[model samples]
Target: MKTSNRSCPPCRSWASRRTSRTRFSEFSPQEARNERLLTALTIDQALDARDAFAKALYSSLFAWLVARINHIVYKGSKRTSAISILDIFGFEDFKENSFEQLCINYANEHLQCYFNMHIFKLEQQEYAKEKIPWQNITYTDNQPIIHLLSKKPVGILHLLDDESNFPRATDFSFLEKCHYNHALNELYSRPRLNGPEFGVRHFAGQVWYNVEGFLDKNRDTLRTDVVDLLISSSIPVRYL
Candidate 1:
């Protein structure tokens, strides 16, 4: 199996050079604009009305080219074995407050909801083979943190929808509470390597999580930026 990590421009610009086929994610609109502005400057063009119009046209063309490549990749890929890692911005402690934090938290909570579904689907498929009473099983029976993150209408998805009654920060804190409430030790309660855990082991082949780092308990916050980036980057680390 091969693995690759994708990064934002700021991070990629600073990354160590490595010998691998480079893959660039499609640039966002702002980045396209910046690229065009730089290109115009290199051509010794003054920033004027005509220059602005030309820059806009060239930026749109550049964006279209990137998007075209992205679409071709999306449509042509036939790799049956593929895993996507997501690495968004990380979370912050109360001390580190900003719109960046809010966006990161908001995104993570929604991800938790997806994580919850993944766990449930795995469990359900396992129980089907075992003839276990699946419906009677508590969704929160094993993954408490995921359950909490996915709790009811108050879950991350609900909170992210701006039309919802809850404020963004409030919804974010609610999900963060679930994530930070427990110490990392909780993973031990569930069977990880053998016995009943093996039932779902086969189905778990495609998707697995690798988590690292720890939160500052005394500070009651997380160093979410790196972890969040990993999660958003197509590298799954939801449990941590």
Candidate 2:
């Protein structure tokens, strides 16, 4: 498979031979806006924005590579046989779990659920239906957990995105919403009402994810200034 990385303007600008920040008219409207937004950010916010941009760029590159590979493989081809390889991260429990860990664990939960339903659940139902002699097997049914993490409207991911839509939503507010919707759920818990961390009980173990940079990471935005700067042109990283 061919690989290509979609680099940001700021990165490209830094590598340019002759770098300078010209007038606003020299840059696109989005680039000017990006610069303004970036200049206004606190040191912490700027750092978070940087990471978010990196993740976004990686996601875009991965998507482009997948699309390109698919196009090459499937263009005018009749499918007779196909093979797919699945490789994904496993459940994680670190001292400080964050947005990435939360998502990874959620995926693991779904995989486990799929196994339980097919191997443990469906098999038993079929056996009982056939009236065959068998032992009643008890498995850890993770339906409740699957519902808690991904159920409609109130799922954690859904709630995060919903809060992200609001211009003023903060991590604390997101946490509040999470706890508010899942107060009765045994699988979810919070040490404090407005804490930076929330705990979830997964099939493997319990994990607490910090919500500090969750919103910014979820945004995956690149300021216009960044695009303009990274392009083959002058971009002012520091004001004169």
Candidate 3:
């Protein structure tokens, strides 16, 4: 079920969930306060992050409910007749995309890679083993694209996470670092000589992502003081 926006949700509801879940440290302000203590963010920025955090919680909760429902509906099925549902967001491209768009497109890249492996690579390999006479079908291998966005150490996500925690980091700095690291990668490119924009060559198409607010989105957190107040307030329910 979709959450209602008519009433103010228990601000501490998010905090309660964070407290119960050892992971997702960003959810609770008490535990998450020290993370950005040194980082200087404006009041407007803090409010924006709060809104983003709430949305993230709703997204996660909905995803969890879907998983539970699927388990209940598909339980005890015959292995031979069982089916897998690959439900995920479609490839997205807009005139001005941000961190969310990048994440969606990255997931698409992984899905496309999975398709290529099963449809082209694995099938062709099976034919070769059987000595079957068939034409080889080539497909775009998205491993390079995956590596561009998710490789260890210097990957875009690693850089983003690192920048999110660092007090001195900014969106401009994040994009500049990405350009410096991925300048030579074919799947990644600089769209302009200046500004916080980068281009990624996805299976569907190339998308230009603006790095504005990228760092803050990556570091999803609520204001510590506001959280303290919410934790002390009474609420109808708290889902952990």
The 10 consecutive residues of candidate 1 with the worst lDDT sum are: 197-206
Superposition error at 13 for model 3 (Å): 10
Residue pairs in clash, model 2: 9-229, 9-230, 10-230, 30-224, 31-224, 31-225, 34-224, 34-225
Q: Which candidate number maximizes TM-score?
A: 2
The 10 consecutive residues of candidate 2 with the worst lDDT sum are 19-28
User: In candidate 3, which residue ranges exceed 4 Å CA deviation?
Assistant: 1-43, 63-85, 225-236
Q: Candidate 2, residues 108-158: lDDT per residue as tens digits?
A: 988898899999989999999999999988999887888888889999989
Per-model TM-score versus the true fold: 0.27, 0.72, 0.71
lDDT value for model 1: 0.34
Arranged by TM-score with the best first, the candidates are 2, 3, 1
TM-score, structure 1 vs. true = 0.27
Q: Tens digits of per-residue lDDT for model 1 on 1-240?
A: 543332121112122212210211111112464573212222222222223333443554455545545655666655332334467644343432333343345455455556656777677888898998758444533343334324465432333342223333343343343344322433312225422110111111111211110111111222222223334442222212
Where does the lowest 10-residue lDDT sum fall in candidate 3?
Answer: 20-29
